[model samples]
Target: MTFTQNRLSSERLAQVSAGSRFSYNRTQQAIGIVHFGIGAFHRAHQAWYTDRAMDAGDRNWATCGVSLRSKNVADQLTPQDGLYTVAERSERGTHLCVVGAVQEVLVHPRDCNAIIERLSSPDTHIASFTVTEKGYCRSADGSLDPDRAGAGSIYDYLTRGLALRKERGLSGLTLLSCDNLADNGRQLERLLKAYCAENDAQLGEWIATNCTFPCTMVDRIVPATTDADRTDIMEILQVQDEAAVVTESFTQWVIEDKFAGPRPAWEQVGAEIVSDVAPYETAKLRMLNGAHSALAYLGLKAGYTFVHEAIGDPALRSLVEQLMREEAAPTVATADGQSLPSYAEALIARFANPALQHKLIQIGMDGSQKIPQRWLETLEANRTAGRQCPAIIAAMKAWFAHLRGDNGPVEDPMADRLTEIASRTSDAQCAVALFGEGGMMPRIWQVSEEKLQALFS
Candidate 1:
């Protein structure tokens, strides 16, 4: 039997494993959080945490997931009543738990106006975002990109929704960003304010006075669900779940203690509510995300698909460790009393988790948007301090090589620009051209052309 609303019941659940189904009353859950980008990561991280909180009596945090672009997630989960299984894998074993966090879903074009209406409602106290870096539609300096706005991006949609909210005189909501960008909440606020100011000054003033944007850092290794994962779910529960999410048995969320209104008691369930999320955000970006990108490009070049396969290779793992320890850590401040050494050790072990087949190419996507925070800022800081980062230079070279049809087909907003840079010869001269004066990366390109060429050489 397949899992669906009609098929799920107390009697049916009794026949299944204890941890495989939610024991609580699903009927009582109501939507409070309106989440953009209903993807695997959200389902595995935020939704999971919210579901646990609801199960533990904090029932006001049920999510109404909205799919901004793709209808695939809605298509898969809506039929199941937004109830999907999360298979947590680790070296010890695997455990399955059904997540009932998202009680309703809205797919764009199907219910575009409804999404806006729901967001404008006073019940929706949080408009959370996990729409990736490019989804913000911002330029290098964090302002709203005129070109992206012209194309009717998320920024346009958000501005329109806020205008509607202002017209309705609804209370302001906290806009939370769970993406892997530095000061993500601040960036979203900047873009939204820029869009609103250009469209309606009065609305912009309302947002500035009413709304709050809180920066957050989320950590988990959630791989895209494969057919094998679905098969395993069927074998375990005698039911097919198309929307099952697979991930490692670890989770962390660091959130700034800033909100426009009341929020979930997420701190009750291991979330670190801090006054400032800058140090934690910077540490994860430079160490974990930067290392992941390094592994993705270098791993792809070495003909490996999974992260474990890349880390299992002693040489590649050593290079990654060296990059983390010798290069990336120096630029990132310590966080939560955890030294870089222990953090790097834990990351290395997490990456080598064979149970979760996290793909390399997935992490390597949208390098143009991802690279600025992951490596560029750190590279600039290191160079300004009169330090050289050979490992970062190597990773940058891998990205350039990856862009030029080396790893696979490129998927980036700046794909054409990357192709243009990659068109030059595959030598240190090309490196010089790409990172030198008048190239794409101005921050890291601050070094002399000779020095850039030398690093690549």
Candidate 2:
């Protein structure tokens, strides 16, 4: 069948492999989740888990995805009847499954009332988010920026939705944050409350009294879906799935056990429901994400395009291992029975997975917003302990070089300012200029001139 004529949909489910088709009745499942920032990561990770739960007989937890800015995802999934494929690729092979957990996709502002109506429904038990760090519109101090909390922001939509729920006398929902932020749930609660407090004090009181924000630590390596991925998915499913996502087989989600309402049996599908997600989040952020950023900048500088290729280089591989082990690992206080060494080694193996084709450039984007949590915190923690981090320093140098367009164009929130700083300042003084007082980063590094020269050399 041709691409246009054989689009994947409810009617076309029988055409795909039996195992890839939804095991449960998709039509009978109700939408219990209103997810913001329905991007590739959300699809390949959270929605995949939700699909697994549904397959295991947990219904009424299907997701309604909200695209805050773009209509691209809505355009892709709506045409396919919200049935998209997730191709889990690895060195072994590819495993394709059609995720039916996302029942609908709504573009915000245009469908704002529909979204609010969904949120106010008693059946909707959760409002989750995968909006990247910048989507929070946080100031440097990590508080919500009131100026950016205008109409059409997630904060605006959520506040309005929650208020409607309150007015409708519906039970409060759990606001789950699946992003890579530190103490994600608490941070989300704090920011949302701040927004509510400023705009509607009564709504803030209602939220404080009723809603729950459960912190989550979500880990997955989902690369941006390319045309090649779409073609491969088409071959496997025998139907066109434009919204198909490609990811590594490995996935982990650690959630704080607190929730305002009933939720899916995500634990049965391998999600960890724990009291504290801090240790897990810190470990993943420092080890996996820090190593990833290092690989991206260093790998690009070394002329490597993909993660597996970069880790295949001995020097880069050793550097990443040391960054995770010697630098990042020490700062992470692991949970009981959690092994940092094993996690780091697993990350290396995952990065070396040839079939995933995770791009260096994709990881490298938004470095200015990402580096603080991924690398700088590790650096600061090591500094506080009086331990040296040559590996992190090397990575930082690579990042600084990256800012100067050593590899290619910078794709960061602070791109223009950072590039300008890199252009005007000397190598020895650049770090100071960027991390010093009035700089982007929180803490300044105190590296000597000799070491700085050695870095460039």
Candidate 3:
């Protein structure tokens, strides 16, 4: 494979075609949003939206991304001068667009002080996060874990930044969470307030009086970019972009219409700013994410490599459809004028997109962090309503089987603990050991031995 030595940068923009490059003047843009977890999802979703908003003449919302841990993203984007490609893939074809929404990428701790400065700046009105569920460092019950929420964590940085903002007499910032967590923005506020109260009461009080954390529902299927994706994108752009992200054509962002200060004209660029985001978020978390997780473990176990392949299989397709329509959808309170049936059908079609090679194992990673909201919430709801979710039960069993190495090595954060429990306990006892009294799950989420045995049977 011959490599494209010409890297994607601002200078190379002149060589690229008109429609593919950013129409807005990149040099004139100001960074108003500092985002955490600068991964493929963020680049493909939020940054892409911001890029579109810029194209529509909103110049101040360009993002300054911070990678909390690895500098891999920084290494990818820094050399490219924060320029990257977003390839929107679908059954039709791939549409490539160069996104210049990110002005800079910073790595935490090393660029810690700079990050805080960026966060505290008056220009930075929104501090957004896409740090996955585990990044919050919450315990099973969802409270902030003191050990994990210390220095170098997102909470610590925000507290320090907010403190500095207060000292500088700048207005409060909006803490926007774009993760899949239910009530993500509010959860962020609660966790941050807890952290601040424990460390600095004054800061906590100020945050309570000033800042706003609005719930948001972000949807996009951005698979991890493979070598083929990079090569394909490079072929299109005629310049190598290591930071290019390939995703499905469908994208949605529903944010609660609450902000501490001015924000981008995101609504103009297809973002939904509503009074309440609960119904939408719940539907998404339960139906889309729950089905994704189920498909991941189940598909991997069934020897399917990509989502399209698994979704193509009639049995797997039926299972996913049942999981979404019967088990997950019933738990969601439909938003005003929102059709759950249509949404579920659209999700099915999205999963079957042949152009996007979404890996099952990629979605299966961090199952411990994902399932509590994805599957467990739906399961708990059904259980409380005296309705059994057989599909969810099957998925749960599949997850357990996955943990036991039936689907190869587990990639969960609690891999050691989970694998230990799965190995030591019998099939009937596995559910009890994992979800029983004093188990990994919360006390309220206890499972019976009979249920496990029935599932096995």
Candidate 4:
């Protein structure tokens, strides 16, 4: 059966699944947060949390989801009145929930002006972003990369919206970054300020005085939706849900508790609000995300398709252990009540979950943007201390090979330059070229070319 508003009712909720939970009063929910990048992960993780918060009577926290790059998500969700299904698949069992936390959905190209107005409104106290790493438009030197960001960048939209808000004499909004990059909130704030400074210094001052960008660490294993997933969701719900998301049962959100205005009681729903999110941010990036990237490039090079398949390989598993225990763990400054070893074990279990087919290619995408925090920073630290990082180097080498079409096709902002170097240079020379004068790698990391070249050798 087709899932439509007419077919959906209080009685129809039972038809979806005996245990599925949903809200019938979605119409009463007000949009308080404007979330960028409403992709599968956002739907599964942040939206799921917001749904739980709304269930607990946090009505003003309903999200207005905006697609910055494409209209695919907006189109998929609009027909269903911003309703979607999220299935938590784990070893224990499968649990389904229909998330109604999104009060409205908008595509940037079509509703650009409307989006500005929505975000600038007094009711919207927070603007959360999950625009992946590349969305920030940072160049190699951690500055705003205008060439990559172009006109449709998030910076462009956000700065313009904030300028409009200032023009309207409105209060500042809290900017939350839920991307996997280390110190994500700080990164966004820097980029946003950089862009604003270049265009409007006055607005930059307003941002500095009024706004706050809170760092966040979000952890969840959410695979891209597949046909089989859709089929299963339809079977369970007795209707088609175009925007259905599948994810692991485990989820965590660590946020810096700094906001300019009123905000949701996200802490009430398993989200840890901290005074300084740096320690937690550093740990997750180095441990969880760092290991995930390692597995992706290494797994692809070893001819494994899924993360589960990759982690199952004894040699690969050993490499992952080495990455977490020897390399990543030493670099992380463990926060209070945090255990690096336990986190590593939990990550291994999460990666090895056969029920969730997390794709290596998905993890391997946007390597240029992902590597600085995930590997390069640690590599630079190790190099500075005269320490060798075989596992980290191996992952980076796999990434270079990935760029060379050795593992697979490249999906990166710097694909052209990386592929050019890979196509022209030999294995050993590839590292020198990437790390050499006028290369993208050097923009992010300041390392000796000789050491980098040795890693390739």
Q: Write the per-residue lDDT of candidate 1 for residues 1-457, one digit (tens) a residue.
A: 5444333333344556766766667777667899988899999999888888787788767798888778899888877778788899999988988888888889877887888887887777898989999888766555667878753466656667777888888888899999998999898888887887777788889889889999999999998999988888767876667788999888999999999998888988888899999888888998999999999998998899999999998988988998889888898877668688888999999999999989999999998888888888888888888887877777888887898889768998778877777866675776776567766653443678888777777
TM-scores for all predictions? 0.94, 0.96, 0.97, 0.95
Kindly give the stretch of ten consecutive residues in candidate 3 with the minimal lDDT sum: 441-450
Name the candidate that leads on TM-score: 3
User: Could you say which candidate leads in lDDT?
Assistant: 3
> Candidate 3's C-alpha lDDT?
0.89
Q: Which residue pairs in candidate 2 collide?
A: none
Put the candidates in lDDT order, highest first: 3, 2, 4, 1
Among residues 3 or more apart in sequence or in different chains, the pairs in candidate 1 whose N, CA or C atoms overlap within 3 Å are none
Clashing pairs in 4: 140-443
lDDT of each: 0.83, 0.87, 0.89, 0.83
> Model 4, range 45-129, lDDT digits (tens) per residue?
8888888888887777788999988889977888777878898998887788888788788887889888888878878889998
lDDT tens digits, residue span 226-340, model 2: 8998998887778998899999999999999999989999999999999999999999999999999999988998999999999999999999999999999999888999999
Per-residue C-alpha lDDT of model 3 across residues 1-457, encoded as one tens digit per residue: 4546689998888877888978988888788999999999999999999999889988788899999989999999998999999999987888999999999999977999999999998889999999999899988778999999998899989999999999999999989999999889888988998998789999999998899999999999999999999999888878898999999889999999999999999999899999999999999999999999989888887889999999999998999999889888888887779999999999999999989999999999988888888877887888888877877777788888888988788887689999999877765577777666666865544457566566555
Descending-TM-score candidate ranking: 3, 2, 4, 1
What's the true lDDT of residue 77 in model 1?
A: 84
Off by over 4 Å in 4: 1-18, 443-446
Candidate 3: clashing pairs of residues: none
